[model samples]
Structures are given as structure tokens and as C-alpha cells.
Target: ARVAGFGPDTVLLMVLPLAHNYNLGSPGMLGAIAAGGHMVIAPRGDASTVFSLVENERVTCIPAAVPLVVNWLNDPALDRFDTRSLTLVQNGGARLSPELRDRLRKRLGCQYQEVYGTAEGLLNLTRLNDDDEKILTSSGAPICDDDEIKVVDEDGREVADGERGELVTRGPYTIAGYYNAPAINARAFTADGFYRMGDIVVKRGRYVWADGRKGDLINRGGEKINIDEVENLMLKHPALHSVALVAMPDPVYGERACAFGVLRAGATLTFEELSRFLLEQGIAKFKLPERLEIVPEFPVSGAGKILRRTLREIIEAKLAAERSQSAGPRRGP
Candidate 1:
């Protein structure tokens, strides 16, 4: 409608990948069209182009990823654009760190909302009304509104509040069965019908909080270490640039924590230094990595995710050689 000279409120801007649910401008445009609103599609979204569209088109709402929104707020060219027209800005994709979320809320003065969803089925959203604490703490409540969420243990019973368990959700709109795959359907659903999310969640008050995936949890001996917590804490180190924590097979402990990370330019760091730092910060010794691999760069997927599975394979191969060399030749006579 902007192309046809429609009013400002009639426009909605999408800055994410069009193929993504957040940016495709499908459901968002649907609401806009019903209200006679216009949808402005950004073929390629960047900090410069996005803010320009917001100012020129008077775009009121934007559904974007957290990293993109952070880039916009920190952009040196922010003064060049007039974004007073923006009322709602939503962010998703990954777990938004508490520090970044607070900066966006307090420093940037934007209405920051957090959303949690999977490409397949389950979707949850955190309302804007919640304080920054809630926004960063919980992944928010179920989006289905009336959906039932239960955190269950191996015995298939609901665990007590704050205890971690596999998340099982049941709702009307939830996908009842996988399409054209009996094998998936068999493992994806519970005997009683709730969808097995595979990811773990904890109940805090009334909200169900995501604890990453079930398989991703690192078991160091008898202790279970949350990789997200460790990764978040590692990122707090000033010398560190990026970090990905993956479980490496261990003979004595079943599986141990291994962190693959990059350091800031011209900054020299060591596993010894990191171990002391984490211990000083009150992180448990078991959670401190048994091995730290310093890499120049991480291997990221097309979607910009650090492929942990790939990284694990590389780490395994390197460690195997080290162990074999230490053991020496069996040898002899």
C-alpha cells in the first residue's frame, strides 16, 4: 500500500529470511491486510536497509532475530534513521543472553519480546509485559494458550517443579503425527499422545523453561552439566570471542565437557587460565572443561549455527591421537 500511497499504519516490515516463519510476511501480512495494512518486504535485511525502511515507510512492527536487533541498536548509523515509528520488535532464533537482553531493554528503549519455537511444531512466546528478568529467565509460556506441558522423568511421570525432565506437550493444534514417517512417529510421541519434544524443560512457577536438548546435557561422572549455562559463562570471559561446548567420550567419567573456543585478536589465553577463571567465578570444578581446544574459527552451518556435531568429530580425532601417543607402542620382542 505504501507503493500506492497508503497510510503509515498500513505498513509492516519484515527483516528476517522470507523463508522463515518470522519473516515470510505470511501470518504477519495476514493481520495487516485484514486491517487494510501494507506489508513491506525486504529482499535482503541489513542494519542500514532495515532502519531506512522503518523511517521511510513508518514501519510499526518488526519480527527479527536477537542478533539482528542488537546490531541495529549498536549501529553507528543509528542517528541517520528516524525509528520513532517502531512500536513492537520481536526476537528469537537462539537463547538471548541476559546481558544482551537487558541492554536492548534498558539502553535501546525498544519493546523487546522473546519467542521460542521449533520449525516442526511447538511454539512458545514471552509477552512484552513481563520484566527483563522473566524475558531472560523463562522461554515463556506455551503459545497454544490452552496447551498442557509436563516435564517428565524416565518413569514417564511429571517431575517436581524446577527439576529437569523431558518436555511433553499436548494441544489441539499440535501435530498429532509425523508426515510419511512411521519411525519418527513411533519415537516422537508418548504412549498417551503428548509430543516428545526431546528437549528438557523445568517448571518455574507457572512457566515451562527450556533446558536445551536431552542428548546435549553433559554428564561428567554423576553430575549433569548444563551446556547452555557453561557456554553463557564462557562468553563472559573478556579474552574469549566465541565458544561451543560439546561432550567428549571419557573412559572414567562416561562423557566429559570439552569447550572449543576462539580468542580475541592479539589476546593469548590458555586452558590453565580458563580453569582458574571459571573456578574463581564459582563454577563447579566438574563443569570446568577437561579439555579446551583453541581454534582460529568455528565451523558454522548455513543458518549461522556452530555445528557442534561436526566440532565433536574434529575434537575426538585430535584427542584420540594424543592418547595413542601417550600410551606409546605396544611393541616388542
Candidate 2:
């Protein structure tokens, strides 16, 4: 409640399920309850519903996924709503694009905070008073005084500040181990008992900067293409409302980065055009999206986080079908 700025006067917008992690999801509902605040629950994140609730209920804060806010900002009817009531928009579950963050500040007149958390109970929050640079670049510091965290390299050695390494943490709120999952628990927890978060990050003092999941890093012919960096650069393109990058199977490299995008209204984007734009932004050639898949919306989990695995599955299916056709139905003769 304190970190998210919820209080008796707070009117939070609840577009996500209560089952979402008690750490950062549930629209700050747990904090709202602790602080004696009011909540407005909406069935969906449709622009009409969100805008209406913000106006009618005078919602003061919203803890939401990155995609929901992008949809709200791109809606043509946004200007029609009186959303001056919004004071804060806390982004979690995904990395928010830099371009979208600037747009939200100008258009909505609210503060933006980035959060890093998981069902395992680690939480990092950007303070409301953090400078523009800190809020824009790092994911913020630990929310609890008892939360113990560290960054370490491949050999289980701790890394210095600003050096990238895997984040491992354990705290009063963090679970000791998964329920009855010995195989996973053995690999998931450290010898010293820290829970391996499986995320690559850089720590400076108490603040953290996420570099995407270790598993999600695309290896193209042994060259690593960090999807988060590529996706942030791609968001600057005029036609994309939002973009997510995931690995697609390649015969030679074994894996290649492919981008999945949701387009802005009336916007048309082709692979060549986006390629040119990214190159203009100075991304290396290997990191270029080998293909683009446009979707009405990205597949989301119950807690409203993007299902990147599902995105990978979509491209794999398409490639399998292509290879089957190229093989001419396995030569029935």
C-alpha cells in the first residue's frame, strides 16, 4: 500500500483477476484493502470500459500490464473521456516500451512506475519520487526492508553493481520452495537458500534493471540477440501499437528472433518497412526480426502477462505446415 501509494482516498481500477500474484497484480487490491481504499472492478480491459470507469469512479491509480495501457492510449475515443482522475499507472508483468511511457505521461498526465515481481514473492518498485532517468531506466528497488536479493554470474559468484547477472532472492514474503516439486526446487533454489529468479538483471544499490529472461534470449548462430533491446527500438516505429519478440526455429542457427506485433488503428506495416526503420535506429543486422506476425492481441495468461511460449508455438506451427507442403505430401505414390 505504501509503495503503490494506495490509501483511504485511493480508487484503484481492477481489470485483472484477484488470483494474480499478491506481489504486484490484482490492481493493487491487496494494498488497497490494507489501506482502506475503494476498488472498481471491470470485466475487461476494453478502452471503453477502462475510460468509463476512470471517469465515472474517478480512479486514482491503476496497476496494469503494458499492453492494456497501450490499447487505452491508441483508442481514438481517448480524448472524449475525462480521465484527469488518474494519478498513477504502475506497469508490471512486462517491460514497458520507452516510447509508450513518454506518450502516457503527455496524454494522461500521470506518474509512471515500473515493477518487477513474480509469484515467488520478490518485488521491486520504482519510487514515486525517483528522478526521471531512474524511473525510465531501472525497475526500482526492493519494496520490503527484509527482502534480500543479489545478482550473480554463471559460476554462482556475485557480480558488482551495474554488471549483468542472474537475480536470486529470498525474503519474508518469498516462498521457501515450490509445493512438492522436488526436481524444480533443486534447480530453482541456491545452496545458500536464495530462490533463483531466472531473470538476467543489473543491480545498482537497491535498484534493478531487467535484461530479459535467460531462457528468452535468442541465440542466432551463437550470437545472442537480446529481444528486449530490439523490441524497445522497434516500438519507435509509427505503425506498431505494441511489439513482442520471441525465438523461432531456424534450420541453421537453431533459433532466430521473430517479432509479433499489434498494429495501431488504420496502420499498415510490412516486414521490409519495419526492417528499414530498425536499421535506421542502429540495431545490428543479426538482431533484425527475421519475420513479423501481426495479431489483434498477444496471448495473455490468467494474470494478464503475455504468453511468449504461445507466440513461439504459433510460428513453429506455421513453419511445420510450410515444410510439409514443400515436401509434397510425403510422396503417396
Candidate 3:
């Protein structure tokens, strides 16, 4: 509210899940009511409905995660709607791709801001006025002025700027320790009293860009989906020796889970069968694998740890090829 250009007339529309940490979906509703501006709630995020709400309600601002924005941009129906009232779009939770950011900025004629935050009390934001490169490239600086951050190696020693390390933070609002797990608490906090974020980050210029978390958790729509837990269930397929879960680029969900695996010799099973097998396990629908590929082997490094990022790249390349072929023009007229 104290921002120069923002005022009582700013209408905020929120469609993110209300229960998720980033939800503040309704907090915007409260802000709108206090400022005497209309608050619009989108129970579910659909492109057509969102565009309609924007036009009908003259929505001036939108709070969304990267996935929602990607889906909206890809939807062909977006061209049929009017969204001129949209002036500002706030994207947070995960990194927004440059392609998506440019599409929204050019097509929507709005300023886009990228924010990085965690339910655990870490927050960073890229200003709207920042260059498109920075907005798309970096997570920007700390939100609160007093927030202090450091990137440290395994020994708890600070690393030089531009080097990748685990991000540890100290701030007034930062959590001091885990609630009841003393074991987790000991590892999650440093002896020097900084909360060990376990997030990989790098310093470039004056901003910090979050790479990914140290733990192999799949961040889908702000919800932490444990990959190992899911992979264990997938291996029960009998035809599969072992499986590794990797995140694939998703225009709608920010990232969707994809499984890469080695099938048992002489075993022939379709993806549908594998999916049904997982469904029977009663995992949350969102946690189910959206795409699955059978590979001869899993990539392993010198230390024998699975190279998940390498597998993710291989799956992404295959998916991209399929999409490109599908979108390719029809044959000779």
C-alpha cells in the first residue's frame, strides 16, 4: 500500500490454491476490501475464465505462480479475450522462463515481477521495473531490508560470491529450528545460528538466483512432492528394476513429475498400465507421474549417485520432439 503508484483503487485477483503457502490467494482479497477495491476469487484457474474476470472486473493486478502464467500463454483461446485492464502481474514460488515472461509482457502489455519465497520465511523479489532479462533470469534481492543471507559449503564456511552453495539465512522472521525433530533441527541449522535452507543458490551481480533444493523434493505448485517416496512405489510395477523421478517443464503446472526407469528383461508394459499401478497405491492425484519413459539405465556419476538432472534433460528432449512434431504443419495441400 505504501508503494508510490499503488493505492486504494488497486484491484487484486488471486487464483492460486488457498491452502498452499503461496496462496495468499485470499490475502489479496483482504487487501482489496481494505483498499475499497473489488476482490475477485477464481476457485480454479482456467484461461478463458481468468481473461473474462479481468475484462469484466477490470482487474488491475494478478498474483499467480509460474505454471498458471505458462498455461494462459499457451491457451489458444486467450486471443479471443480482452485483458487490457491488467497492469501488473506478480509471479513467485518458482523461476519463470524467459520465453514465458516475454510472451506475457508483449502479449498482455503488463509489467511482470518475479518473487522467490518459502513458507519457512525466506523471501526475495524482482521488481517490475527490472529489465526483462533480470526478471526472467534472477530471483532478485531480499524482500525485507534487514534480511541477511550467506551461501556456505558443507563445512559451514561461507563461499565466495558467484560460487554455488547451500543458502543459509538469518532474519527476524526466519524459523530458529524445526518443531520437534531434534535430528532434523541439528542438520537444518548451523552452529553460527543461521537457518540452513538446503537450497542451492548463486550470486550474480547484486541478486541471488535459486537453483534447486539440496533434497530431491519435487516442487509442484508450491507443494513438496517427495521423489524417492514416489519412485519406491513405481518400482513395485514388477517390470521395473528401479526408477528415478525428475521434473519436466510444464506450461501449466510449472513442473510435472516424469519417471525414468529401466524395465526388467522380457517385461512389456505400457504407460497406462504403469499409471494404473500407481493409482492403486492411493497417492495424491497430483503426485502421480504425468509422463513416464523406460530407459536402459539410470545416469550415475563418479560417486555412484544418480544424475537426476541428466535424466530430466533426456526426458525433456524427447517430449519437446513430440510436441514439435504434433505442432508441425500439415503435409502438402
lDDT of each: 0.73, 0.86, 0.73
Global lDDT for candidate 2? 0.86
TM-score of each: 0.81, 0.95, 0.63
lDDT of 2 at 34: 85
- lDDT (C-alpha) at residue 144 in model 1: 58
**Can you write out model 3's per-residue Cα lDDT over 1-333, one digit (the tens) per residue?**
222124577877777755555445223454456666666787567788888888889988887765467557656778887888888786765555555667678889888776676667767777656776777667777766777798988788889999978888888888888778899878878887788877788876557877667756677887767674577578567787556788887877778888877776688778788889988988888898888788876765431346788988898899889999999977886
User: Which segments of candidate 2 are over 4 A away from where they belong?
Assistant: 22-27, 329-333
Residue 281, model 3: Cα distance from true site in angstroms: 40
- Model 3, residue 58: displacement in angstroms? 0.8
Per-residue error (Å), model 1, residue 220: 1.3
Off by more than 4 A, model 1: 1-15, 22-89, 302-304, 321-333
> Model 3 Cα displacement at 222 (Å)?
29
Ranking by TM-score: 2, 1, 3
The pairs that clash in candidate 3 are none
Clashes of 1: 1
